[model samples]
Target chain A: MSSYHLDHLQHLESEAIHVMREVAGEFERPALLFSGGKDSICLLRLAEKAFRPAEIPMPFLNIETGHEFPELIDFRDRRAKQLGAKLIIRTVDDAIARGFATPKPGIVSRNQLQTPVLLGAIEEFKFDCCIGGARRDEEKARAKERFFSFRDSFGQWDPKNQRPEIWNLYNARLNQGENMRVFPLSNWTEMDVWEYIKKEQLEVPTIYFSHERDCFRRGGQWLPVPPAHTGATTPDPYAGARPTEKEPVKRLVVRVRTIADMISTGMIESKVHSFDDIITEISAARVTERGSRADDKASEAAMEDRKKAGYF
Target chain B: MSATISHSRPPVSHPVDILRFNTCGSVDDGKSTLIGRLLYDSKSLMEDQIEALERSADITGGGQINLANLTDGLRAEREQGITIDVAYRYFATPRRKFIIADTPGHVQYTRNMVTGASAANLSIVLIDARLGVIEQSRRHTCIASLLRIPHLVVAVNKMDLVDWSEERFIEICDQFNEFLPRLDIKDVKFIPMSALNGDNLVDPSVHTPWYVGPTLLGHLETVHIGSDYNLNGFRFPVQWVNRPNNPTDRQLHDFRGFSGQIAGGIVRVGQKVMALPGGQTSTVKEIWTLDGPLPEAFCPQSVTLVLEHDIDISRGNMIIGLDQLPGTGMDLHAQVCWMHQRPLQRGKKYFLKHTSNTVQAMVTEIDHRINMATLVPEPAPAELVLNDIGEIRIRTAKPLVYDGYATNRLTGSFILIEQGTNATVAAGMLLPSEQLVRPESGDYVI
Candidate 1:
């Protein structure tokens, strides 16, 4: 008799695949929220396992903050094309130009601005459900989220009034105009994601590995320094506010631990190069994965506030 | 093992075992505090997390640091000094990884507790040492049993408040054991500890010299949950049909497979299987995992199964072994825990979602409500209010393949959704179909 058992990584993969299939079966207009991050990359692999022999039942949706890493954007588009899935991109720059969102004065980071663009895209595409790669272990607010999170007609999430999800039965019923944000990787931790990437041999943005780049220090984190002022018509908003003389720009060898907007995503000074190195580093690290994300460090309730405002 | 790594560091090479459990008790029984102690002592708390806890100490009042703040993430929950929702926390020791579902312990939040316990392999029922075995303790224990949780740990908290008396701990243990036999739970372990003072949580405390049992964390790390899954009858509720149909790749041109997570038992290639409701028989040709094809698959592992001959199978269809077949019927007798604000009344139609199948169902009769305090069945309750547990008879529009809750949780459990609001109103555990009320009986006339 063969003893069949799934290790932790395989178990998480199974659970995630099951959730993706559930989304495919229940929703008429479901889309995968592909951010080109490690978690989202894992989602793509799970999607392949879920609906193989057939195309992923839904399209790929991405909300682009114009300030995103060039590598991430390139990888996102190439992967989507390789899979032959429909890719829909919505930009924060367009949301600002259309008067749907207004940039806060002197605030160059478009992390908060992406929420409106995402909501607009959802409304325009009439996506009944959007599958995201958000994991509960990422933040405190995320820890309270349900597997099948229900959103009101306005896309607002009421954390206190979430539907009770019992066993494997997910309540995916939504009224017209209402939507659901499905998270298939809710139970996965950061280590699990990296281990899975290694097991599946999935490709990620090259920036995740060690590289040399010009960087600057701000708020105790290393951030890539923007190139010399390119005098364009738009006039980059971030250039308007330069780093103080106390925080000098210098060329350094560093790598990004997470891929987000280029302005807010922090680079860590490390010699770690491969996925194995990353797993070892993460196991010995003291800070949470989101500690490097300046967007979430704005306040204690930063994620909760964004979630309430319909941010994925 | 590497010599360069320090002995104090967590062992990373061990095969990681995942344990999911929930903590439930009365509001002030220190459920959250016990979880915080476990995480803190296990060295799972990061430097930033400890700093955050220290920073919020002033806001939460009391010169002392409030450990409960770790699990209570929501602003409202922190301000109200209570856990209002189920917040999941992950931590790991050298031995195992754990997912802690810190559920609200208030009486009105029974639905939240039920949600937390639904997927737990074990349940920790906290009891205040000063106030041994109260009504809330009994209520939570009954719920743990109803959910069919395989393991139970009765943590007698606040042992310091009771002067660390061995007699007091024994008294509480005796009280719990008196009622535990009535429930179906087989394994029960009791421990005396103080979540606030950190006694006997991760390390054995000198104050409890009279106690000779594993520490709370020790037991959690070594508890035998290997046999929790049902490995007797093969049942696979198809979640999707994998048909790639890619023309360029010759191998993918004609691939068709039934995809789902195995809910029970072990399935091997060449095994004879039957599709439920259709009664179509076929032999399993191959089992496919994400990595590659496998010769055999077992319960809880999601895999795609290829059959020798394709019969009519789709989502909501169950593939099972012919030997221990599940009951097929339209009438179901079940025990339901009402979760909605509106009372559950007879004659109301609902969307009964069992496995992947959803069917229109109606509450034909309300048998009786179980009084949590007395553990007695009250005859003929007119309606089941929010958080009430009662026996009910339901009739579905189509036949459902199922087993008794005692036999198989995945195949036996279901949720009732209100047709209009689509809100999940109740969670139900099916009784055996033989006990189902016959249509010819006088009860069906209503």
Candidate 2:
């Protein structure tokens, strides 16, 4: 006997690492989607393993929502600087100014704003593939996505029309002006990610850990530090049904469950502050991470619809 | 974390606790409704997903939250009241995470079942109570066994439709029991439930007081999947050559290493290993994980292995233990399940995708067709058609390093590609035969 136990994590890592190397071997110019989230952090580490003892040659690309948590921005910059790797930030705000993307007037969400920014970045960088940390277990629409998801020049994804990839071979063959989205962590689960972060001892943004923050109520749940801008709702600007004139704006101490753009993701009352606490809380919690994603919460096929529109 | 798996659980839970499993059974088996119950009862569902279920509940006879719609997400599926394609759904619990691939029950989508079960460690084969044991159910079990899923959960759904009759459940179980001995299956658990009313899903129902097994969720969480992975033999297919091309980077200037994930076994530093095809030998210099140096890197792990010698190895070639070096040959006799619409004719060329390598392959001979439904040998079949399981002789343009599927799934199983269109035509599990019967011939196809 080899005397080694069945190492599922190691197995998942190799699967991901093999995929990362595939991206490097197959594509001409590849970039990784780095959002400073735990999943992206795991992706960063896998990239390191893919080409360790050497620097990650691929650049870390980010579609800055403009409504990013300030803490995440600082961490993103610092980490990129530490790795000595290229950091490409394409802002949705800039795209909005360029007429590439336009949200409804006075809309709070900058999420829909990310698509044009991402596509614009792909165009500017001429990247053939953009590696992302999208796990299939995250959502139904995401589950239907292939490992080597493709996009047209216009950056549209037609789920009905996708090429079949067999065996371990990914046919990254694309025509001119076409690009691919590679998700190495597609097979991994949420718990797998936290485990990897701990094993690798990766330095992630602090928002992942539970922390006290001022919040209001929304949709029978809490919202930590609600965005100053409001979405297209009037009955209750945010904190749900209010009294005739106004109810006291009580900002209660709350912690975010999933840290998306402030406009989309909501918060919960969780004292589980550290990674350990978060794991425990998640273990007992009945809801999935995306339950709070305003966009996902909006429609059953919202994620899928967004994906078809080049929103990874 | 559960005490049983914690020591094995990688402390850093790879950011997702998602476990992907598949359910293979025909229509009316309540595949969708079962998934609906799991999601609804587990409380992993959101209010909106539930509301969507309610709004379109009329798709089924009654306007209830037709549980099947939970997985049957497509509008076409709702309209036809059938799962046409491979439908995937996501649900999670603190103990673990899950993604279910609800494959269509129709025989036409057998290829989809292959696609679903390829990456899955477990296969949940649901059988309707009214139809105790049918051809579709048998075919599913055969495919699951063929795919080498370590664990099998047989959910006898629609027990309510059968009046929660233990006799019906027992009869189906008895029918399935007859065929178990012919195949290699470790764990098989039978659970009877009514997906409509959500019985024996997340919680055991009071009616089934006679039944004393874990609930569906309980079994899903506690299944002994630790020993399910292929960790016995070491198999590493080099996916890339990691070389930093920066001239200013002196430390990385001369670093040329074969980078790939460890497919099967552990590779320890200074451990003697051999490269296949060329048959060259070398010792492991360093096993590199994402962080830095590691004492060893094992199967299913993605790590770069640096050999002490500059042995010629590249993508598609594998590294294995010197003692457990795999057989190398151009001709292989494998138990293949033909998945193409066109029948698999002898002497026809196709692309064979094995591990990270894709090479030209031709079906040299068709030994016999094993009827997936009957589970019997049609030894004299001239051709294998869609969803047909049979032993076929395949000759590759180049040598392939492989092991028996029973021994190492990662190394044993391979897919056939249609030569002209490059479509994946078939999937095969190898059986030891022919050349292995003779010593020095260097010819084996299974």
Predicted structure with the largest DockQ when compared to the true one: 1
Q: Taking the tens digit of each residue's C-alpha lDDT, what string does model 2 give over A1-312?
A: 235543446657767777888888778999999988788988988887778777786999999877677888999899888888899988886887889888766666777778888988998989999999988767766766778887888888776555444335576656789999999988776666776777777887877766666655566556555445455564323332222233334555566666677656676766765667666666555456777767786666677778888997
Top candidate by TM-score: 1
DockQ values per model: 0.66, 0.27
Docking class of 2: acceptable
- The count of backbone overlaps in candidate 1 is 4
Q: B353 in model 2: Cα distance from truth in Å?
A: 2.2
Docking verdict class for candidate 1 = medium
Q: Among these predicted structures, which one has the highest lDDT?
A: 1
Candidate 1 Cα misplacement greater than 4 A, ranges:
B1-11, B248-251, B435-446
TM-score of each predicted structure versus truth: 0.96, 0.84
The DockQ for candidate 2, computed on C-alphas, is 0.27
- How close to the true structure is residue B415 of candidate 2, measured as C-alpha lDDT? 80
